[model samples]
Each structure stands twice: as C-alpha cells, then as structure tokens.
Target: MDEAARRRWHQQHSGSWLQLVATLRNEGWEAQVTCEAAPVQVEGTLPSGERFYFRARHSDVSLGIGGDDPADIAEWEASESHQEASYLPAAVGEAMIRRLARRYLEER
Candidate 1:
C-alpha cells in the first residue's frame, strides 16, 4: 500500500498497534516502542528486554524501514534508558507503526 493509505489505516487501528506490541513480547519480539515527538525519542525493548531507545532527528527515518523480509525490523544501535523516565506519545504517523506491526503479524 501507498504511504497515504498506510497512514489512514494506522490511525484507524490504534488497538491493533498496541495488540502487536503485546503480541511481539509474547511471541518473542519482546519489544515495545513509545514514540514522542516533542523531544524526538523512541524507546522499546529487545527480545531479552535490554532497554533500548533512540532519538529520531528526522521524519525520513524512525519506526519501520520496509524491506524484502517481512520480519526485518529497523536495526537499532543506541544506548538510552527508558527504564526510569517517561515521555509523551510520539507524534510519528501510525501508518509506519502499523506497517511494521502488520508485517510482523503476517509472518508470526
């Protein structure tokens, strides 16, 4: 689907996105992302729950990076701790988030 379509789909399905997060953790992905735009930071977990968070400086990136592999998640290599502080929800379009979640579910 195109970007615009994806955005609409994502916005309309908030519960689906959250469901994916829980499913990920339960199915072994074990990572949940909390996106906030004010400060531009996205924090989530890895399979082992090794606190992982990254700052999104640009809209061109962050969230999902579509790939040939349905299970291909964006590679994160940063060190920040969300294990203590909390932030607002990210302003990122749900389309991206939903896209990733859909792919994960399809392959799950």
Candidate 2:
C-alpha cells in the first residue's frame, strides 16, 4: 500500500485494538498495554477468564492476537515478536477482532 493507505491501515488496526481493550475493560476485565519501540504489546484477561496477548509492529502494523493456550503463549513469547510488514487492511483487522471476540465469548 501507499503511504496514505499504510497510515489509514495502521490507524484502523491500532484503533480497533484499542477499542477492543477498552471494551474488555468496560466489561470489568483487566487489560494492560505496553507501547514500546517496535512491537506494541497488549496483554490482558478476557471476560471469559482467558488470557490473551496481542503483538503488533508500529511501523508496518502487522498484528496477531492469540494466547489462550499455554503452549501458544509460550510460542508467541519465544517468537521474534518483531515482524515488520505492510499494514493490514482495516477489514482484515476488524475480521481478526471479530473472530477473536467470538471465540473468546463462545467459550464463556
């Protein structure tokens, strides 16, 4: 994507993540965010009692959120945690959040 498209993508993706965090917090769940240099980390417990950690790059804006399983959480932590790439489309980001929310809520 071009510069403008990239900026829009990042804005949408980051905004959605922020919204999700806020929603979770509003529901009385504990959420924490650490905006570091490259990979911005948002780790918290969902209302369903499952813990999740989302990691995304601020530059390229590629993001992934999944950590309910202990093994998955360990793997996520072991990974490079810094994959800079093109920003994902807003639709893609929203779809990811929807899928995660559905999975999280369904398990409750």
**Best candidate per lDDT, number?**
2
- Residues 1-108 of candidate 1: C-alpha lDDT, one tens digit per residue: 999997776565444546556665676554544543333443454454333344444323333322332123443331223322222233333343445444544553
User: Best TM-score goes to which candidate?
Assistant: 2
* Residue-by-residue lDDT tens digits, candidate 2, 1-108: 899997876676777657756775897666765542244555666565656665545433322334555224422232222234234333444455455556545544
Which ranges in model 2 have alpha carbons more than 4 Å from their true place? 1-20, 58-95, 104-108
**Model 2 CA lDDT for position 53:** 61
TM-score of each: 0.33, 0.43
TM-score of 1: 0.33
As for candidate 2, its clashing pairs are none
Locate the minimum summed-lDDT window of 10 residues in model 1. Answer: 78-87
